[model samples]
Target chain A: MQEKVHVSGGTALSEQDVHSGEIFMTEDSLDCAFAWDTGVAINRYLTELKNGRIIATECRHCNRIMLPPRLFCELCFKPSSGWVYINDTGVVNTFSICHVHWDASRIKEGEKPYLPAVIEIDGASAGMGIMQLLGEVEPEKIKFGMKVKAVWKPENERTGSITDIKYFKPI
Target chain B: MAILERITRNIDNRFWDPGSEAFPVKNRYTAGMAGQRFFKEIKENGKIFGSKCQSCKITYVPARIYCERCFERLEEWVDVGTEGTIYSFTVVYKTKSGKPKESPSIIVAVKIADGLLIHRLNGCSVEDIQIGMPVKAEFKPKAERRGGIEDIKYFKPL
Candidate 1:
């Protein structure tokens, strides 16, 4: 007969015991709050979005027009010189159909999977893109470099955040 | 760039109120070697046990498998009884939400044998508590305990 494993003070917990939740375990969290500081660059970029427009910064050092404008040129390692209006139109550079929420909860059955995409914005430097969602199209039809346009929320409802643009749709 | 000359120096002044967001994360903690026995005893037998380090001539609460100071293997178990003396204490007037409480609560560090256990002191007023005051552990009803610290509900004045 196998004696019941007793631990007066030895390693009594085997790998199987822990895996089966037979040992003492508890759930905890970081328990922290946070705030976001969208400095001079993204701050103004978001402000422009509230007015149903897009903007980009120009770095004279490298002659690049950067979307979601910031103060500095990342490549040239210098400050950006000026800002310019960028078009709301773009192309779907890449995308994925997500079956679950970011936290890993599944979407309700019969509901559509979210279409998160990276869109290369018009008037920005080559390869510069923004992460947005695609709507009003079938998941099976989404393709590379598909022409798309930003669908903005009404002016009165707009908040100075990325949500100002409701989504992107095929142009 | 004609726009460069007209750009104001304070580029940040024109923005709106700052936004806040959260990314909640989950975590887990497991009871290891010594804690397994310590908690199991409380959960199963409604008793508290501490490891006795004979060479160091000291005992630890929530017992350990090794002597922290002497580096000796502590195989002897000492039943540091539920009764104890108030080693230290404090009174709390603020709630977790930051509001001042109508009545303050007393917290005590009860020294059972040579081990110290920090827990709530109920069934007594704040003014009635003092260092070296005798107290005893009040175990929760048998069915309610799940082999954790909550097995002992609180320490009360004996």
Candidate 2:
């Protein structure tokens, strides 16, 4: 006979007894929430975006104009000197034709593949670029150093967001 | 000195409120080691297993590999009871997003002789469920079992 231990107020089954379908087991869900703060620099950068203007923070020491503006110069370890408005026109620094969406979902047949690119804005400083979507040009025609310009949403629809610039189109 | 003053004047003092912007995320989780074994036992064998601490002589449901009280490895496994008493419970009237639920869910901490197992309560009204009320685990049909807590649909009055 197999050994069995009885709990004070419950019946305990042996390994063999449980294997015979005398015991029971289950699964549950959990939810999480979060709030993120976009501090001074990016907040003003977005506000300027709503007004159809592009802004970058200039670091007086290093003399570099950084986009997606930072409150401080990362290299100089000092507060940014000031903001400078730059032209929307830029050059495509690099790009990719993505067959899958940001969430990794496959694009359907007959739908155009998304063209995401890093665009080096015309002013501010060399190598200062921000990632944005490429549009209004054939995927095969896009190339490094190709000039592109911002295609803004109607002014009334602008929400002071990166999406305010609908996409970057070949100039 | 003039440049420093100009920089100070350029800094915007107004802060943007949270609802003005949106960021969304999705995550996936996997069960590991002891949890996989416990769920398999429930799904494949229709059994409930608990880990027993040889040092402290205490057993835990939703089996753990180590004992919390003694900090000892719990290698001994035991089968605990299917029926248990409600140790505590709460009625969830709102969803995680703060929306009211059409029908509230009763979540309970059930006390088996071994330890407490938290799960949902069913087949009884929210007003009828009392602390210390005896309830029995109700497993989904064997074919419907997925080796998770949902394998046992919910606990009902014994």
Candidate 2 error regions (>4 Å): A1-38, B1-46, B65-75, B85-106, B121-146, B151-158
TM-score of the A chain in candidate 2: the value is 0.81
Per-residue CA lDDT of candidate 1, range B72-146, in tens?
889999888789999999999998778999999888899976788889999888767889999999999887876
Best by lDDT: 1
Which segments of candidate 1 are over 4 A away from where they belong?
Answer: A1-33, A74-77, B1-28, B53-58, B65-75, B113-115
Interface RMSD of 2: 6.4
**Model 1 chain A lDDT-worst window of ten:** A5-14
When only the first chain is scored, the TM-scores of the models are 0.86, 0.81
Candidate 2 C-alpha error for residue A66, in Å? 2.0
TM-score of each: 0.78, 0.67
In model 1, what are the clashing residue pairs, if there are any?
A: B43-B147
lDDT of 2 at B129: 89
User: What is the alpha-carbon lDDT of model 2 when measured against the actual structure?
Assistant: 0.82
Clash counts per candidate, in order, are 1, 9
lDDT of 2 by residue, B23-118 (tens): 444443334456768888888888888998877888888788789897877888788868889999999999988999999999999998678988
| DockQ per candidate | 0.37, 0.12
